[model samples]
Target: MNKVHYLNSHVEKFREDIKITIDVENIGDLTHYCNLHIENKKVTKIFTECFHKKETYKDLIKKLPDTVERLGLFYLTTVYWIAYTCHYHNDKFDEAMGHCLDSIDMDVPLLNSPHFCKKVYYYLNPIDEVKC
Candidate 1:
């Protein structure tokens, strides 16, 4: 089994969500994967329509602090990419581990900054994305 690492930010509903964890082996590649894809139309549409905040990726990026916004958008877009691949393209997450870990890395930095933590809560709370 591949080793795994958890992100400090996670979704807690009826149960905690493991969606933020990533394979340890892919840690080195996270930045590459994240940088490769900046704009996703499908995820953008979902964020704008499904969520009440009416947040397009760029909107969230503009409103939050640079580091916080980068992490948040990276996290959101990565998850959206995974969902998009699974639901629309029929790709299993295991086949998309690179992207998954990239998104997970986005949240790793927030673990160290209290300010960013608060910002993460503020940014994520509106979308029902996670708990601090």
Candidate 2:
């Protein structure tokens, strides 16, 4: 199978897994956000067109590292968004916090928001630490 086709299949499976694991109500919003970003980034056109030529497939393989990094960022962003939504709206604060902390523990670049950082810090180092 061509690399593009293989990558596309894996992505589709991941999407399916996300749909199964995420709340049904949230799936529509997540799909809309992802589709909007894909359209704005022109990533859809690139992947669709790249499969037509052998050279294009090879080129994609050569750029695999960058592709993987972008994909990782996409996955992380999705997880972060779900965690944020769950924490604030779904009353799944502990689960959401665990997801966020797991992401951080993976040593990926941290989210830049101070509010998120503060929440995580407080989560790790509870209020009792300073109460005494």
- Which candidate has the highest TM-score of all? 1
Tens-place lDDT per residue, model 1, 1-132, is 323323222322234334544433332232232443555544444444433343343554454344334454556544433333444445464545544345445423333343433444344344555778
As a whole number from 0 to 100, the lDDT of residue 60 in candidate 2 is 36
**Residue 85 in candidate 2 has what lDDT?**
48
Pairs of residues clashing in candidate 1: none
Candidate 1 segments exceeding 4 Å error: 1-68, 98-132
lDDT of candidate 2 at residue 125, scale 0 to 100: 34
Instruction: Tell me the tens digit of each residue's lDDT in model 2 across 1-132.
Output: 999989967866655322224443343233223422342233323332333232232343343345434443343344344444453446665455567677556322233443444445444434664564
Which ranges in model 2 have alpha carbons more than 4 Å from their true place? 1-80, 87-89, 99-110, 113-132
For model 2, what is the error of residue 97's alpha carbon versus the real structure, in angstroms, after optimal superposition?
Answer: 1.7
